[model samples]
Target: MTGRLKDKVVLITGAASGIGEHTARLFASEGALVVISDINAAAGERLARELGMHFIAADVSKEEEVERAVSSTVGWHGRLDCMVNNAGMVGVVGSILETGAEDWRRTLSVLLDSVFFGIKHAGRQMRELGGGGVILSLSSLAGLVGGVGPQVYSVAKAGVIALTRGAASELSAYGIRVNAVAPGLVMTPLVEEVYGGHDAALRGGAAKSPLGSAAMPQEIAASLCYLASDEARHVSAHTLVIDSGVSAAGAGAAPQFHHQPADFLGRLPEQYQ
Candidate 1:
């Protein structure tokens, strides 16, 4: 009854709630010696205790904190097998004109700079350990298209994808695999809060997808597990899209197209339907 990540030393940032929390639980269930890192000390400690994993209270945006997180994990486990840079926030919600410089910088620091820090430290650890490790990042469907999210948030996520590609290219030389997951509308706690409630969030999320449903946090977590596991040994520098076909349909594109009967074309007014 060996698990997919048996004995693997995995660290997940923002492991206190939502997708990060779910991923921590799933990784532990799969036999990883999970280490949970988050800015929420109380929730992170509680979850670590619940799952018998180590907890590190570190804001992923801080390079020093991020470096320490990786170092601490490696110190405890003797090697770092995987690092999931899942910490993020729905940055200031507004148009480009409405977004201030502070909001933009903070959003990028969390969503983009944090990944860079994680890759920098984790990549070094893996290389020092004699090669081989996985780095998974949380991108979004908004990163792939415009008008789906706040300007700052979208820009940050798009930067994550580009970072993933660039890091993967360089890290491959050291047996490290870098990849990202772009989820569409996942009904996490933050999302529910924004939409007012679970029902509203689900309804809104499902409306944007071709599947008629929003993704659960667990669904996105599952994708993380796959990327972290040995099954993805050959897969690198790839951003897996787990949007339930939303991206394929161009996010919010009309699901149905109108068709006119052959005889009805001329009956319609010019420039009108």
Candidate 2:
């Protein structure tokens, strides 16, 4: 039987791992001709082979690489319908004061400029298709608020949300839809590395969640499917937060340090709790 994306052509960056890998598999399973772009040639080729999709070793942060990847997909598939800007780097876990200039540039280049390149090149291709295309970005809760670790990552993500809004407003005139997905702490390989590859760290991330767990890559991939499908045709310039309510209450993995009231003990002692 045919699928929702049968005959559609989708291009996804950072397609070698994490959300991008899952998204590529999901899109191909749904019958779309997938173009997987990533700097990791081996993983990209493996996934493309496994999923029967096209693979391109291109760095999304570079304009020439981004252009070549997008052009290659359009040239190979005849038309481009969906673009997923999922290429990004996880910066060092440090405060803004500790973050070096080079690290900051790398973080912004990977997380922010990559998306900008995707939108610019993909926008051109989708416009050629007369619009009716979708551009989905993988932003984070950091995009909306600031918190623990990686100041550069946070700032870069914030830029993604702003980019989403700006592109959506202008691209709508051309019939192209632009949106973003802000994933909470998901249990991807990236997070595993963040946890020092310890199962306990994964468990800690899960335990910290308001939902008692973080999401799986598949969960985020499904959201990507919905966003790319025609069902979300009217949805533009919006961020679908898949953060398990962490962004809402600031619940997961964050410190809570509020002093208990000492009204009753106020009369008893000055140093009492």
Steric clash pairs (candidate 1): none
TM-score of each: 0.91, 0.89
Q: Assess each prediction's global lDDT (C-alpha) against the native.
A: 0.86, 0.80
Give residue 112's lDDT in candidate 2 (0 to 100). Answer: 91
How accurate locally is residue 205 in candidate 1, as Cα lDDT from 0 to 100? 86
Please give the range of 10 consecutive residues that has the lowest summed lDDT in model 2: 256-265
Inter-residue clash pairs, candidate 2: none
Q: lDDT: which candidate is best?
A: 1
lDDT for position 220 in model 1? 93
lDDT of 1 by residue, 100-165 (tens): 676567678888899999999999999999859999999998899776776677888999999999
Model 2, residue 129: displacement in angstroms? 2.7
Question: Candidate 2: misplaced stretches above 4 Å?
Answer: 252-273
Name the TM-score of candidate 1. Answer: 0.91
